[model samples]
Target: EAYAKALRGRTSDHPVALPHPDVTSQDPLSKGLGLMERMAEGFALAMDDDFNSREAIAKVLGGVREATRLLD
Candidate 1:
C-alpha cells in the first residue's frame, strides 16, 4: 500500500510519493528484503499443522532463494 502510494504520488492527500526509500532503491539486497518480507507474511498467514501448508511454505522459500540468486 505504502509502496503503491509512493509510486503514484505523495501529498497531504497522497502522503507518499516517488523517491521514497522503498521506491528509490536499485539494490538487490533491498529488493530481496522486500520479497523476503512478503514471503514471511504469506508463511504466517498460511501457517497450519498440515502437509500442504508446509509444502507451500517450502516452495515459497525456494522461490525466494532463486530470486535472490537472480538478483545477485
Candidate 2:
C-alpha cells in the first residue's frame, strides 16, 4: 500500500498490495504477474553482466507460476 500510495499519480492502482513482508503475492488473480515477469527479465539481463544468475531466473519463474496458479 505504501508503494501504491507513493506511485499513485505515476502509476495506476495495482490489483493488490504487499501488506505483510512474509506474505507472498498480494496480487489478485494473476494481475501483478506481468510486473513480476518484467522484473525477472530485467533482473536476468542485469545479472548477465555478473554471471547470469540462473537461480534468480528460476526463482522468478517460480513466482510467476505461483501467482498464475492463484488465479485458478
Candidate 3:
C-alpha cells in the first residue's frame, strides 16, 4: 500500500520514487515488484481470515525481504 502510495504521491523523475510506466515498456523488475504488491494483498486477506495480525505482519516482512533481494 505504501509503495503504491509513494508512486502516487511522488513527483515525476524523483529519485527513490517508483517509476510510473506504461504497460508495454516497463522493466521486468517492476513486474516482480508487482508480485510483492500482490503478496501484500494476500497478507491482508490472510489476516482477515485467520485473525492473527502477527502472522500477517510476518508475511509482509517476508514479502518485503523477497522484493529487496530481487532488486539487489
Model 1 lowest lDDT segment of ten: 16-25
| lDDT of candidate 1 over 5-64, digit per residue (tens) | 455675676554233223125654455556666666667666753545876678598657
Estimate the TM-score for candidate 3: 0.48
The backbone clash count of each candidate, in order, is: 2, 0, 0
**TM-scores for the candidates:** 0.43, 0.35, 0.48
- Candidates sorted by TM-score, descending order? 3, 1, 2
Model 2 RMSD in angstroms = 8.0
Instruction: Determine the backbone clash count of candidate 1.
Output: 2
Candidate 1: the clashing residue pairs are 10-16, 11-15
lDDT pick, better of 2 and 3: 3
CA RMSD, predictions in order: 8.0, 8.0, 7.6
lDDT per model, in order? Answer: 0.58, 0.57, 0.66
Q: For model 2, where is the 10-residue window of minimal lDDT?
A: 20-29
* Candidate 1 vs 3: which has more lDDT: 3
- RMSD of candidate 1 to true structure, Å: 8.0
